[model samples]
Target: MNPSQPSAPVRILVIDDTPSIHDDFRKILISRGNDASLDAAEAALFADTRSAPVADSFVLDSALQGQEGLALLERAHQAGEPYSLAFVDMRMPPGWDGIETIRRLWQVDPALQVVICTAYTDYSWSETIRQLGSSDNLIILKKPFDNIEVLQLAHALTRKWQLARKLAARMWDLASEVERRTDELRTAEARFTSAFAASPIASTIQYNYNHCFLSVNPAFLELTGQSMGDVIGHMPGELELWPEGKAWLDGVSRGDRLRKHPAKLRTRDGRLRDVLVSTEPIAIDNDACSLWLIDDITDRLELEQQLVQSQKMESVGHLAAGIAHDFNNLLTAINIYTEEALHECQPGTRLHDDLQEVQAAGRRAAALTRQLLIFSRKQFSELAPLQLAEVLDRILPMLRRLIGEDIELVSEWDSGLPMILGDENNLEHVVLNLVVNARDAMPNGGEIRLALRQTVVLASQTARHPEARPGQFLVLAVADNGCGIPLEIQQQVFEPLFTTKGSGKGTGLGLSTVRTIVSQHKGWVELTSSPGAGALFEIFLPAAPVGTVLEATGTAGAGQPASDRHRGTERILIAEDDDVVRNMLAVLFPRYGYQAVLAQDGPDALAAWEKGGGAFDLLLTDMVMPKGMSGIDLARELQSRQPDLKVILSTGYSAELLQQGTTPPIPGASVLLKPYRPDSLLAAIRNTLDAAAAAS
Candidate 1:
């Protein structure tokens, strides 16, 4: 088919019985000119403008018989140059005839162009056609062969054979290429399948029409604890792996693609897991599908919940702190007045008994407000390094009566336990509130256990208590066989005002105050509980240095009327902010048998002192004042004027009154918390004046 190269020589094979006939056929075909133009008058009449040029010369070989001719054709075919055309004698053999030889040769090379050289009497054309199936490669020739006719047959048939060979070669190349591409595609698919099977992320491919998994990774099976057989043919909803799984199928069918759907799922074994599922639209077999990626996020969500709750509790604590301060000031006035009335009453009288009841109620109110101040971390702590065991000894008597006969209160202490730096009253409140909370949990009554021991916390162990660091600590544990906190809401129980008790049944500040006070002492709380198994609360406080001595709450002694303890002629200057509280203080000391001067705030008291020419023996001042100067500044000025001036400072909770370190603002000044008894006020005043007198 290529037109540029010189054409291959037309090789011919001639078969006959005589050697003369073989030589005669070769001379006519092979010994011809290279330019063999088949163009005659008819060719000229029907030719296109560009006609094919003359073919190259013919090359011929002869065989004396049919067998010899077949042998010669086989040799040429194996040598890569088979004859394109053959001339056959009609009566060639004593063995095989030309008709049979032609049949055999056509079988060997089906495309071979042939000329049947025969006389009319030798065989009919119809018979020749019958011997070989009719084909374009076959041709007829007369036995008295013309040289021109033989040459033309050789040229045209050989040219047709060359075109056929080129076409076959091109077909072979195309088949090989197609087969190679198919193998490559198969290899790549195999690799992708292996990788999908081995993946760690939970991945799945599902059908678009049915929402069934087309393929699932091993991790997807592992996550749901389902086998491949359980997953493949079924929808995700069918297996109950997703929340309201059947409902989601409706959404997906509506062409809604869920990018990231987060929800809780229960596994096959019934473990709840928080998970995030993301989906991408994919194409599978002419329909759009989904590729899903799932992640387990249970622990992460719990930690985030803890962080949010902590921030909420902290915000509420700040608000409660301010309210507690103002409340204490009001309670202080009520308590002192009640105490003053009690001191004036005679024993064993109905009026005296009523006043005693009022005093007790006042003391209880004061105690409750102090706990509020402690929860806010605003109250000044009366902290000293003390033995928890010793502190428990004094509080146990009161706890036994408070717990009641319905519930048994048991105490266990480890002897020679380590010391902890803590506020005695505040620590006692921690135990009181925890025990009271425990008592409420058991309406039917249950045993409460109180324990004190020394323990060490390592860096790894400190994770259990987020507010604490690695250190030695004294642990105060309280356990009760009461209705326990639920697992889901365990972290919320310590939030202020968050309670499970019915209306008016509980204040809900009990555990919140316990946690707040313990945290203020650089300790942490740990809890362990089950729904019906009761609860255990352990308070861990940083241990004090070795050899630190224990401090105690002062012991009381039986005495005469508290009002008769102190009598002074000296003028006492009082500085207070609230009008009712100021008036109460003004009338109070005079009842105690001492002269009193009254002023509303710091500036008023200072002006009164200057106008009186410093005639006061002692300055009685409130720590937090509305305007002018604070009690600390007032005391500083008064002391400068009279170096031996005695002083007493009163406060509930005030940031302004607290100094650097845990010490009181004014050095050498006596301090009284709000709502103090007439006896306590009288004692502090008497002690300050006496100490001044003794020092001078």
Candidate 2:
């Protein structure tokens, strides 16, 4: 196919009687660079009898012995040699004349070029041509044929043969190229098919309208339980086992080309399976085909259902906690009132003793409510950077009391442990819950080992605990040499209301609440136990900065001491929509030597502040009310009017509004959690007024 290659030389064969004719033709052909050979009658016969030379040749006669030339032509024919031009001499005194010879030669090689030579203008020559058939290769010459004519015929015939050979070679190359390309295409298609079939997700191809399957990979066959023979030509919807096939076809007809749908399929064995199917439209040769990908999501869907159930239980727990919180506030007020009344009477008096019993009962009810709030995750956590050593130092005495005198408690603190961001009270609860579980695990007696260490959780380690993220963590491990949790019940230990303990022994919410609280703080809990070995509960919390280690100064067993009760007559504005709660505050504040003004909502509170001539020492407002205004908005307005006014915003559920910061700066204030005691309320008001006076 390279154009620079020279063309092959043309070959010519001339058969005639005269030696002079042969000489003339050879000279002409050789001059044209065409390789030519002359074979006399004797030589031709000898060459034909022996091995013939691999070259084109011309035979000649003396217009006599025509039988000899004819014999030579038969020899050439038998050899399968092509003759380009044959000039036969006419008027030969032989068995046959030149015209007859030409006719015979034409019969021998239809593609051979022939030219007749004669001395006379014979009409019989025309008759010979008619018998030989109308061929472009056949020509006639008058006697005394000019050399020019002979040379011209030789050149034309040779060029024609050359062109024919070139065309044939070109076609052969083209055929080879086409075959090679076809093989390559087949190989690529095979590779693609292998890759598609090996994919983990099930893949299939179906015709657009009829939904007839075009091709399905092995995964598809495995998923559908149908072979290529069963599915290829039939409409997918017609297959009764695949109900979703009909729905999928309907969706495609409505122009939804790509979709993700969940389906239930009946397999070949009549087993039903849940499948998630995704389909995409592929256009091949301008015809639409659909590609389907399927996944088995029954297990995943079931887990999600469990998660939803868990969330619902958590919601119920929150509702219970809110009720408990409200009830606790009422009990605090009742306990305080009863105690005050009891103190006024003599200890032996009947009324005094009755008041004492009421006070004691209220205190017990309040403790139960606090535990309920903790279980429901409604109790506020005072989170701070804490050291493990300090927590142990403070909580050991209480822990000893909790486990009783029979069981010994030991601690192992890693001195290199980093500070953890957590609530000290919640941490104590975590310790208490684990300790109590350990105690129950060993009904008789056992030692509780509490250990803390700095650890790193890598990405590889996170696989076992799917909820955990890889990072450096502070591991607080509680291991008890007690009877271990059973393998069957280990997973259920963190489920709310699930317990191994009998009904009266436990509420079954302790471990569940511990896990919830830890999760809220972006931490994870791991429980390891078996029948013989003691249980190990490892709590992993992300480590805080080392510089953040601040020792906790307060005792874990006691709340912060009440601030000095302020007895000064200070004007306090209270905004509350609840009339009963408002009336209680109004009567209670004045009894503590404070003037309390009332307002039903934000508007009324603002109006009362405006009328009070800026005389109020502090603004105490509820967060949610009937009007469009909120406590935050009212506080902003009050601050604008009286910049120095102290404000304490109160809310039952203010989580949605609280942003992440030490102090979310409202214009005039600090926020107080709702349902506060009289002492706490007085302390907050007193502190705010004192700070205001100091700033002035």
Candidate 3:
């Protein structure tokens, strides 16, 4: 096929009734030296004023019949050395004629050159032409042909065959190369299309001149809350996708590269989304285009804000814990000494009454600090399975009176409701806060309704409320027919310190505390309201698992009267960092018939236990203390030594939170909240000792 190399000899096939014809062709085209006359004739005919005709240029094969010639052509082609020219006699008998033979030859090798060598007028030129269908490969030579003419025809037609073969090979190679390149292009196009459509980054193609969207992938549609029908062939301005950052697009239009340009786009749902838009210049169908990669950062930004808010709340909790610790200690001292002063005075006297007032004020201050701790999630809560109906029954009378006689309070709940695991007191606060807010919404007075029922959240519902999951829940709905909340400010209603009420009229902590308590209980709150319409707040709490036994909410003898309580003479180790709290516990324990030893911190308490040879029956220690140890650590170490040391771990911080994953909790260790009364403290010590005694 390559022309640079020597070509194979042109194969010639002679089909005739006489064998002499084959010899003649050989002498002229193939036989060398013996065909001097033929060579000279060919030279003279072709103007070979050059040299004798090139020798052995043709390979001749003999066939006596048209069928034989056709068979020879087929054999040569199959052998990869096909005959280039076939000379056929038209009047061959007992076999296919020249016309039929030539036609069959062409079917096997259409590129073969054929010449009809006929003496008789078997078929006219018109008839021959009509039968063979005009072809440049066919030629007619008369029977009595001159040697020179024969040589000339042989030389010219054989050269023509060589040129034709070369051209055919070239064309074949060219077509093959074209097909390969086309396949490669098709594969590349498919890969690009697949990758673009499947990319997680929302991508679109826009016509640069028109600024209209040419194509958008699924992620692009999802990010914009639009469909293909909505976006395709539409300009971004027409879709209002870019509410802001048109300047970024303008710069891109001016050939500036847009890389991660921060922008805001309003989705079809009318919510603004934060996004990073990047662009690439490309050409499609010779039309200038731009590729827009949009990274929707709406959820990402919300999560970032939530993380910042969480960190802020954690810092606030730490600060509140520190404040509550010191303040509760001070309150404890004031309340205890005031009670002692009251006991020393007559009930009718001014001094006794004033001490009572002072004690009441101290208690109120303690309550406020407790609220601060609770809002910061540092307050100790006693979690237990509680009947919501029972808790509401006990608190509704107080709530009714708090809302004033002008406002009507209505309550209803489903019977046989499942219990929820939460702190009863905290759940009470949640209800109280919602009811109070409902009351305040209507200055002119309105109806406040409370409804409770079981609810099951489905997976589909979780899409609307991210905090919800498929599970059983108890919903407490609080509805108020009052001036409902405006939609614009609804999201901020639960944020700390956000309020619509005038200064001094509200502290803005009610809903915030409600949110905190609900979250701590592993629940969520949903609000339905519109300005000038009624508002409804629903609290969803997880239901306790079936067959869960309810645990006692209070310790034994928790609310026993002081005069009727049994006194203990057991030795107590009191570990508190606050000097006043430490001294007050030391002085008060002995009056309850309990001997007390004082320690400033956990390490001091540990050292005192070793000094006393582990004789103490109880360890009352602050949960958070200085000197490289905490109350939990002290209890773990002392219980290891004595194994019977009863512990009452106390803290102004959340004792439950502090004890989590710190160590396996000291077995049978009780927790005591700070700002304690003398009676409560004595009762805790007595009950703890009694429990240990009973266990022993």
Candidate 4:
């Protein structure tokens, strides 16, 4: 016996009074190595005291005994002790025969192996075998049983008991392994649930075709404004608030996986928000489900819109700056010639008064040019304390004339309003543009009100207006009780060249110019309007520190004096490549008392200046001349030769040159923009000479 195996061999006890039966059983047990010690009827009564080691034996001849062998066998089976095998004689005469006794023993211990030894091989024993359910462990030995046959039966029963024990042990081991794996799966599920619920982004799980909600994280619940009980197990589209849910579900159903797709949804609060949704399908237990990840993109969309608007404004500003540069040159010529003609005429003469009007109109035209420059962000701004209320008061009469008589004009100004740091003219343009727009909104006549007041905008308030900054602001609001803007067109109202008015009736640049000017002043514009309700345009400009308003000092018009103009005797070099433009200047320059010298390009201009024998009074050169030699280079060469030579650099686009200062290769030089009238050319020449003489 192995020490590691179960302790003790199975014990068996048998009782019989017949000596011959005992001898036969002993012979069988000795062959099988199972020591069968027979106990006589008297010894069996004191079986506990007889320590000769109880042995398994066949019980026989029960009818001849005072203490029946059947009774002894019954006592052994009822002992509740471990037993391997038993053999009983069928001829035993008692309350139960051998077959019946074996059956009762089986009922007491199904694990106990039993067999019957009988003298007669008859049908009665066969019938009893059938009654015992025909167990394989039960066997019968004939009377006068062979020793080998008895030994074989005992060995077979012992092997059967060993096999049963082994099977039970394997079953318990397999059950434990199954229990451990199930526990591990449960723990993994708990971790997954915790991670999903803790994420900030909205997450959801849905079945493939039906789109039934399997699970949703806390963020999804918060975003949809629904409880877990309300959402779980329901169809996603049944929420009613998510208009695009069906479209997303359909996309998911068509494929096993998908990356992020842009989607717009109406939230539970009825507000439209943009989201990026991604989905992937997973097969679980022969069924498919999808996981959806949602990222909110409302803020990103707004930022894109602002970027588009900024780019549009930049393009429009470039256009405006180009126009203003050319227009200013024309004004300069008109101003100079008109002043000259006025000085040469007698006072009150028709020609003199006509020249006076021309000069006045030129000054107004110059003012318009400055406005365009401001809109294009090309002009230099001198910030000073300015009362917004007072500025609005002065602008009301002009606004009234602009809106015309059909529209009733109204003004409301809060007394002692805070001042703002900005150019007064630019502010006036913003106000005028708003009023004009309002007038157009109501062609049939309506009330237009200009309101001015002091206001403080906090960080919270600035969120609504994308361009607003947190600070004290001078709020200038222009409102009209008229037909309002359509929602579809409201977003594009401030875009350059976008207008609802009929073609030629209004230039779409007005509101765009307003926005540019306001932005340049570090301010923001707020627009509120809807169809059928009036529009309100509010501008918030940063309040300036309290100080005295700086009075701008300058002549009524800044132009050269007529008497000290350059004469034809003074040589003037004109460096312009365009034939028409150069020829026009060539023809116009001599009329202004200057001997004109022409140059087809920058090198030609340099040659002409050197060919003049270094006697030219001024060098008027176009900034961008052909053949790689710019006017600035020519001017520098001329200045080196004749240090006192006056130079005026001109260009169609002077923004880059202007930022480098009003000089070519050196500071403090003069510059004139192109497309100039004759007078502007003369005035520029005269101003250059005056500035040169002043510098000397």
lDDT of each: 0.78, 0.70, 0.83, 0.70
Ten-residue stretch with the least lDDT total in model 2: 1-10
Residue 213's lDDT in candidate 3: 90
lDDT of 2 by residue, 322-390 (tens): 687567547646765675466468988899888888877886676566556666766545567887568
TM-score of each: 0.63, 0.58, 0.79, 0.66
Backbone clash pairs for candidate 4 read 333-679, 333-680, 567-593, 568-593
Q: Is candidate 1 or candidate 2 better by lDDT?
A: 1
The order by descending TM-score is: 3, 4, 1, 2
Best by TM-score: 3
2 or 3, which is superior by TM-score? 3
Cα error, candidate 2, residue 139 (Å): 25
lDDT per residue, candidate 4, 388-499, as tens digits? 7877877677787888899999888768777778877777777777888889889899899888888888888878777877888888889998889988787788777788
Candidate 1 lowest-lDDT run of ten: 1-10
> For all the candidates, what are their Cα RMSDs to the real structure?
9.3, 13.7, 5.2, 10.7
